[model samples]
Target: MIAQVQKPIEEILEYLEGRDKVVLVGCGGCATVFHTGGEPEVKEMADILSRHGKEVLAAIAPPFGEFTCYAPWSSKRLSKYRQEIEECDAILMMTCGDGLQVVRESVIEGEFGLLKRIYPATNPTGHMGGGPALFKEKCQQCGECLLGKFAGICPLTQCTKGLLNGPCGGSQDGKCEADPERDCAWMLIYERLKKFGELDRLREAEPMLKDYSQMTRPRKIEVAPLVLE
Candidate 1:
């Protein structure tokens, strides 16, 4: 999981100095789990702004993240906040790059075409766990969730060596043969899979030099706006 932290209060104060009425926006999905920013942070921000004599119009929550499932199903959530966000001086986005970009574009044409915007917040860094908690994994951006396929473990992405099969028998007692801090990739995978009932997927025989064009590295996808008839 990625562990993202918010910027210093002084830094945010600089951007929010002039704006009296502002909207503190948070992605309840990601921002909530990442613990980077949320209503608590918003309240903290509000306190700071109020100390400096700024009136926060509202603190709005939207559903966002890699899984943008919540907002689409619950349109009423954002619909209620649209007026507040539009009329307000600014929106402090507490989300990932993707979520923030969408929020920024949500305002099509402002009165000034320059509604003061700022990403004064820090970037998100980590993986989403089973309970949707952030696990603070390194920013590998592996683009592959091999943990499931590997019997609830990840060797390719987690292992420093990027070993697909795993470390040789030299690895002892979960510790990596090469490094103590790191566990033996294959051993961990084997044990985890054995714990789970899906060990059958393990013996499926992974191919060497397989073409994964669909799962290309550093993959970027093109997204067109939704066309509603």
Candidate 2:
């Protein structure tokens, strides 16, 4: 899941400066799951904006399945609220950057003039696990999967120093030197490998350094179109 945290109210107010008649758009996907942009949060934002002397023209929660980051879905869902949105001076999107981009694209394609500014109200923290209490970041989306070699622990994230090979010299008593509160990532990997009798895997030559070229920016993929014979 995409983890996110609410932006400071002062930052939001600054973005909304000189703009009244605001329309609030909330996401029902990751933001909702994180309790940062659900219906209740949207209403709370409206109240705060109202108290700040800004008029809230509407607070819209996109219908289920209409994820705010899916352009086609969000575009269709937003059509019904076009009039209300057009009437507003700005839109405060209680969602991550991806959702904000989707909404902006919808507004452009829907021919709602560029006069209406779209602003993000939440900052994406990182991708995380789905459990209620599992807020810790689990993956870095580095365009590489090293779980098999590391025994499922990501040293890039779990280790304070992001050591790929093994425990640093600073590790003492299975505790991390960077942060004594956390277990050393390499130690955990060793214990896990030992339990599985796969310690020989570590005896192999160290893996090559990660190639970041695979993670080039503005990446995209396309599936070939199907044709009937």
Task: Highest lDDT: give the candidate number.
Answer: 2
The alpha-carbon deviation from the true structure for residue 161 of candidate 2, after best TM-score superposition, in angstroms, is 1.7
**What is the alpha-carbon RMSD of candidate 2 to the true structure?**
3.6
Q: lDDT of model 2 at residue 25?
A: 89
C-alpha RMSD for every candidate: 5.4, 3.6
Q: In every candidate, how many clashes are there?
A: 9, 0
Report the number of the highest-TM-score candidate.
2
C-alpha TM-scores of all predictions: 0.66, 0.88
Q: How far out, in Å, is residue 61 in model 2?
A: 1.6
Q: Write the per-residue lDDT of candidate 1 for residues 65-177, one digit (tens) a residue.
A: 43222333223354566677667776666656655555454432322243546454656655544445426353244555556577655666666676665555677788887
Query: In candidate 1, which residue pairs get closer than 3 Å at backbone N, Cα or C atoms, i.e. clash?
Result: 1-126, 1-127, 1-135, 1-136, 1-137, 2-125, 2-126, 2-127, 3-125
- After TM-score superposition, the amount by which residue 193's alpha carbon in candidate 1 deviates from its true location, in angstroms, is 6.0
